[model samples]
Target: MSLISILTPEIKKAVTLLFDANIDTIEFQATRREFEGDITMVVFPLLKVIKGNPVELGNKIGTYLVENVTEVQAYNVVSGFLNIVISADYYLDFFNDVKADKQFGMVEPNPDDKAVMVEYSSPNTNKPLHLGHVRNNLLGYSVAEIIKASGKKVYKTQIINDRGIHICKSMLAWQKFGNGETPESAGLKGDKIVGNYYVKFDQAYKGEISELIATGLSEDDAKKQAPLILEAQQMLLDWEAGKPEVISLWKTMNQWVYDGFATTYENMGVDFDSYYYESNTYLLGKEVVQMGLEKGIFEKDPDGSVWIDLTEDGLDRKIVLRSDGTAVYMTQDIGTAIQRVKDFPDVGGMVYTVGNEQDYHFKVLFLILKKLGFDWSTNLFHLSYGMVDLPSGKMKSREGTVVDADDLMNEMMQTAQTISEDLGKLDGYSEDEKTTLYRTIGLGALKYYILKVDPKKRILFNPEESVDFAGNTGPFIQYTYARIQSIIRKADFDFASKTFSAGEITLHEKEKELIKVLALYPEVIQNAAVNHSPALIANYTYDLVKEYNSFYQTVPILGSDDENAKMFRVQLSKKVGETIASAFKLLGISVPNRM
Candidate 1:
């Protein structure tokens, strides 16, 4: 039922006919915009082969396609471009096919296949989820769903960065200043509990460093002075040794962070199949390093550090193990990958949905994995999205400018509520109903904002500019869905029970365009899945809704007394509502029945 399978065959036939007619060197393409054409064949390349004027050649090809192609009702030639429009009857037939088949846009799976593992949102436990993590979660979830829709088995995982010097800082401060305070007692988020300590540590350490410098210690010496590092370092030692008190504190604090994160994930509508903790996996890196040394894949530096050579690959060499026998970040990733593969033996690919800042890191990891004789290492994919920047440049955590995930969601919801009230859309909504609508509108806005653009593109996040409710935004699409819902409710159309005349749809131009878009849902999912870009689905959904809205604005359905007119328009709206729901599902955005 995928549109591409049907249209690709049509494209190949058209290509064959063009070649047979002595037209050479032309490329056939399908476009979603500019023309109501299913396919656009750029014939400028064939102008030289035909030895004729470009426009005339285009006209010739257009005539030939319309005359010879049964799917094409007409073809328009503009500036050497031939736009072959499919028959309106064909679109109506496509709509009927989609309405009849539950798996209208989804393709049949290949009998044989490979598995894909996606790792995303590996947040540190010291802080609550933030906007950057939100982007990561949405991209990861969307990619997972899209891949599944494309008939691939996908494993979704996350590696919690639960152990490090940063964690020690939080532990140290909490031990010194927290005085038995707990999230339950303070009513603060688990991450916030740890994060308070992190901030306190910074404030205290900065002053302590300044005092040391005032006592004439050099900046470097004061910063890394023995006593200062001892407090933080002791926390790590306590954690490693599983000191009863430290272990109890760590367990309590980490559980709270996990609980808070679960709430955020629930709000965002994202889930993971497996969760990996660095507290456990950090030690795993050593085993991989030992194995690498045994296999002669890595050599020790003069300082007793294990290093991997990367100069030949046009990158600097990287450390795998430090002189003191401690594993580095890259080493932990290796162990994690190995563990994951063992967990899912048939996994053929590993997709790391981290930011672009780690592009070089993944490249080195993939190369090292390949050198270590892992064939599937070649399938390593880094879904590196760009950093979210503000009008004031990149967001920095140290400067307290990073947007917390919970706060951002609250602000978006509040904004959605204000807009809803201003528009008079939910005037009589009950408090509970209003709450539900707010969640839908707020989440839809947040998701659409993050996903409407290409992931790898650096997007400017302006509070005033980012969350537009009108053009190309989530609310617009949701509004279109709501309008369709209203239409269905008002008309009380029982499309599920009633049958319409197969070809009697008096399709309007806009209705035909909407149907064509609705027919592309499965194809869009497949493309987005392959590219690992949720933005594609987001954009497609927005476009679909926009067209549906245009059609709705132009055509009246329920009021029409004519059976064919009313039924056809109702059917079109039904298909649109169905298609939009599917697109929203792919983006991890939910549309309430009312909103």
Candidate 2:
């Protein structure tokens, strides 16, 4: 049992026995650094039921606890806080319980528990992914892993925007400018090649608009009359009509983008259980809108469009379908959501990993689902995150100012290489090993830097700052893990085969502190799961590493005066490394065995 579990009821019993007063709850926190206790119980909350001086009240409860519950070794009354020092046996017993258990801090999923579908990295097929997509993919993948760790069956999914004017812009531009250039011919990734055409289309459209404006046409009229845009729109219409040439072109280009996306996802270590394409699902929600209209959940505009009036719900009326009865993005999203539930019958909830700009959109969508009377609508969540900006400012995909995901990853690796070499640590590594380590450290640095902060806050990422070997970064935690691994390697004894008991060996304060931090791993995972924040896992691992480092510096592992103490400390270091690896696994980061 945890310290909290063992002590809560005991404290309640102590209060009743001593003060003849009943208490409903007990609040326990970690003892402050200046205090000489393991766990502190605030006496202020108990004061409501027992009328007395807090120090005296704490002393009475403390005295009762030490005499009765054996785990309470000692206590100190500091104003309202009753800091209780738990017995060394308690920490040792806890450590022994977990020492041999490899998967100590993770929960086993109940077979009867409902599954959760996490939707993320739903990139449009028109362009290659950018820095914003990097954050989305990392967050989504980490959250899925964390949810899985929290004992829920998780399915990772994405909705690809395959059919739209945006997609056709690339296609039309490719046909107009290319001399039958393929991705192979262009010597580029398919998405990168296609993305070039997308930018080309924009530049050409702007040039046409400028010419039209020079002819005395208003800016809006020039934009509407641009020949390039007109052709792209026509291509979209042709695609919708299932014209052979346009449909064939659309399929070809979309396949290129998918191939490119697969490579990127593989490199970035994100995966999807299923994919939903807009071409197939665009018309899905039209029927749902009709169903909503018949059920009075939605209203029809005079132009034969579908809308849900959410003004009474504190949102404006949003269109579901166009006047011509074509499905809008909202309509497609509705159908996509319902389709997921049908696809995964066991799913009881869904998390949409989208940007904060669409916060209102999800609110309105969830409300509409609830109004449409889906039982699982209440379980829906929007894991909305803010944008990632560079020091240079915002990124625009069409303008080509955006930081490409693949390029940024390479840059991160290069940065890792530069910093690692400057540190002069790779003494005997092979070329392949050095290269692999650089990529691992680079990616780890990138992921940990972004994930260490709250998801709702925008990040101004600095590659140099993130790759540092010290402080609250990925390399820091990873280096600590590596250090533990080195200790385990040098121990010369079979530490894994032996288990240490809580004998007459005296406990070091550093050892107790390290175990205490280790004990919080499971609680941290649960908290991260509840809040849908990988930041918790990232930071919790940092704290664990910090504590372990303090223990390392202050105490001896292999050279301890006592043989059993030395072996136990070595085992403790091994377990700490395992826990760090487990936590980093939840954040989709890899730890190096050497630094």
In model 2, which regions exceed 4 Å deviation?
Answer: 19-22, 47-50
TM-score of each: 0.91, 0.97
Across 1-595, the per-residue lDDT of candidate 1 in tens digits comes to 3334544455445545765545323476765477657777777776454567777766766676677666677778777677778777777667766676656566565647878998889999888898899889989888888888889888899999988778888877888899889888899888877877777788788888899999999998999884646788887898888889888877777888899899989888999999999988987768778778899889988899999888998988799999998888899899889899998887889899999989999999999999888889998899999887756666655335678899888988888888778878776679999988887888888888888879999877654344456888887788788888888888765555455544555677887778877877877887888899989998888888878778878877788877777877887787778788888888888887775
Over the stretch 243-345, how does candidate 2's per-residue lDDT look in tens digits?
A: 9999998899899999999999999999999998888898888889889989999999889988899998888999998998788888888898999999999
State the number of backbone clashes in model 2: 0
With a 3 Å backbone cut-off (N, CA, C), the pairs that clash in candidate 1 are: none
List per-prediction Cα lDDT, in the order shown. 0.80, 0.92
TM-score of 1: 0.91
